[model samples]
Target: MIEVRQVTKRYGTKTVVDALDFTAKPGQVTGFLGPNGAGKSTTMRMIIGLDAPTSGSVTVNGKRYAEHAAPLHEIGALLEAKSVHPGRSAYSHLWGLAQTNGIPRRRVDEVIELAGLTSVARKRVGAFSLGMGQRLGIAAALLGDPAVVMLDEPVNGLDPEGVLWVRNLLSGLAAEGRTVMLSSHLMSETALIADHLVVIGRGRLLADTSVEALVQEAGIGAGIRVGSDAAERLRQVLAGPGVSVASSADGELEVSGLSAREVGEIANRNNIPLYELSSRAVSLEEAFMELTRDAVEYGKVAA
Candidate 1:
């Protein structure tokens, strides 16, 4: 597990991360989400000790990352995929880290296979494609078999297959009771993979909750969409206190205040022939945009 308590990061007079507090728990994938300049990278850097917190603390398991005798075994991070030496082969790069950390050399081969880099394990780092480099970085992160894994934009340059692989890898890690914290801008992919989310905006915590909870709280249930030959009759049937009915260009009804089941029953009772009845649930992307709309710091404006 990773715990960040009242953590803050400042540069001169500017505060990038404001008294942030959240936890990345074991047995789940926690998504760290924020827009550009929202201090996500800064907060992640503090988690791995790449950057110090100006105030408060960030601990992995029970101690600070630097305090651990074998930090790799506790937490493995991939904050930058291009950190490897350009002249070294993928295997050589991982071998060097393993040698320094006293990790078994055999683990390097295992991670190579795990990250699907076995075929190109001997290739030089500088020659690897963007996707291949991402795979190599992930391979290094898994080399130590760390209990906590933190990755920023793990699927950055990945293809569809690689993206799916990452999703499966995160799920597999969390299933083993490891802590998996990932930061990504792919809202659809994040929705599919993450069990919980830690959203930040301008270095402040906007939301920290489960995927289901966030969607529910967003109130995306735009009500049931109904299609009927007797659209006017259907609207009347759905109308009541707190109920609203609107017509679409396609001659269907967008209804609120009544459940799909209730609408169907009402239509059946009223002898209204219906063609379609479906409940509308808010998508993760929509909910995310709604939550972070005000928090976006570097958004573009349309002319």
Candidate 2:
């Protein structure tokens, strides 16, 4: 498990991460989300001991990353995919990392096959494509067979198949009761795999909740889309305190603060004919935007 407690970081006069606190439990995929310049990278750096926290502490597997006798065996991370030497082959790069932490040569072969880099295992790193580089980075992260896995934008430059493979791999890791924390801007993909989310903005914690709970809290697209010949009449009937009825240009009514059953029963009592009534489930992207709207540092100015 990974625990970040009241962690803060600073550079010169700027604060990058501010009192951030969250726990990534084993047996679940926790998505770490934030906008650009939101201190996510700094926070990840602190977790892996790449940078010291100005305050508070970050622990992986119940101890500081540097304190672990075999740090790689405790937590494996992929912060940068292109950190490898260009002159080395994929197999050589992984082999070198394994040697540093006393990892076995067989484990190096295992991760190469697991990451689907077997065909290009002997290819020079400088000749590999972006997708292949990402695959190699992932292979390095799994080289230690660590209890905790952390990856940032693991799907970057990946094709649709590679994306699916990563989704399944993270899910499988969580199933084995490992602590899996991944940072991604792809909300749709994150929603499909992450059991929990840790969202930050402007160096502060914004949300720590389940996937369903966060979207529900946003209340975007949480209304019922009702279509009827008598839309105006239906709107009138549905109008009351605490209930909202909005009409679209296409003449459909979006009714909120009421359930589908409640709307149907009310319409039935009023003899309003309805052709369509369905709940508009909010997407994860919509919820993330709503929650972080005020925290965006480089927002576009409206004309």
Candidate 3:
């Protein structure tokens, strides 16, 4: 498991990560979400010991990364795909990492196949495309078969097939009881894979909850759709403080600030026949935008 408690990082009076507390537990995939300049990359760096936290602590498998005798065996991370030498072949790159960790040559070949790079294992890193480079980075991460896996934008340069492959691979890793924490801007893909989420904004913790709970909270106050002959009258009756009723182009009543059950009960009490009434489900992208709207560093203000 990965544990972060009251972790904070600052540079020259500018705080990049605030007092953050969250756990990426074993047997689950925890998604780290934030907008641009939200300090996600900074936090990931601190976790891997590339950057030290100004205060607080971060631990993987109950020990700090630097304290581990074999750090790669405890935690495997992919921060930048371009960290390898451009002249080396994919197989050579992974083999070199394995040698430093005393990992067997068999493991190197295993990861190469697992990453679907057997065909291009001998190709030079300089000749690989962005997607191929990403695959190599991932293969290197899994070389140690670490208990904790952390990735930053693992799907950045992947095609659709590659993206699906990564999704399945991460999920499988979590199923094997490894702690998995990943940071990505892809909401749709994240929603599909992550069981829990840790959201931050402006270096502050915004939310830490399960994907289902977050979605349910976001879907609250979403408008309800009602199809009834008395749509006009129902709109007037539903109008109140914190409530809004609008007519769609199809003459359906869009009622906000009311739950589907409440709308149905209200119509029933008022003797209004309802043909259909359902709450509109909010998309993950929509909910994320609403949650981080204020934290967007480079967003444009509409006139």
Could you give me the TM-score of model 1 versus the true structure? 0.94
Question: What are the lDDT scores of the predictions, listed in order?
Answer: 0.91, 0.95, 0.92
lDDT of 2 by residue, 131-194 (tens): 9999999999999999999999999999999999999999999999999999999999999999
Per-residue lDDT, model 2, residue 231, is 88
lDDT of 1 by residue, 1-303 (tens): 999999999999999999999999999999999889999999989888889999999999989989988788889999999998899999999999998789998899899998999888898999998999999989888878999999989999999999999999999999999999999999999999999999999999999999999987776456788998889867876789999899878888888888788898999999999889998888878888899999898889989
1-303 per-residue lDDT for model 3 (tens digits): 998899999998899999988999999999999999998999899888989999999989998899998888999999999898989999999998999888999999999999999999998999988999999999988999999999999998999999999999999999999999989999999999999999999999999998888888999998899999988888877888999898889999888999999899889989999999989988778888989999988788799
Q: What residue runs in model 1 are displaced by over 4 Å at the alpha carbon?
A: 240-242, 265-271
Residue 278, candidate 1: C-alpha displacement in angstroms: 1.2
Top lDDT: which candidate number?
2
Candidate order by TM-score, decreasing, is 2, 3, 1
Off by over 4 Å in 2: none
Which RMSD values do the candidates have, in order? 1.8, 1.4, 1.4
User: Using lDDT as the measure, what is the rank order of every candidate, best first?
Assistant: 2, 3, 1
Error of 2 at 2 (Å): 0.4
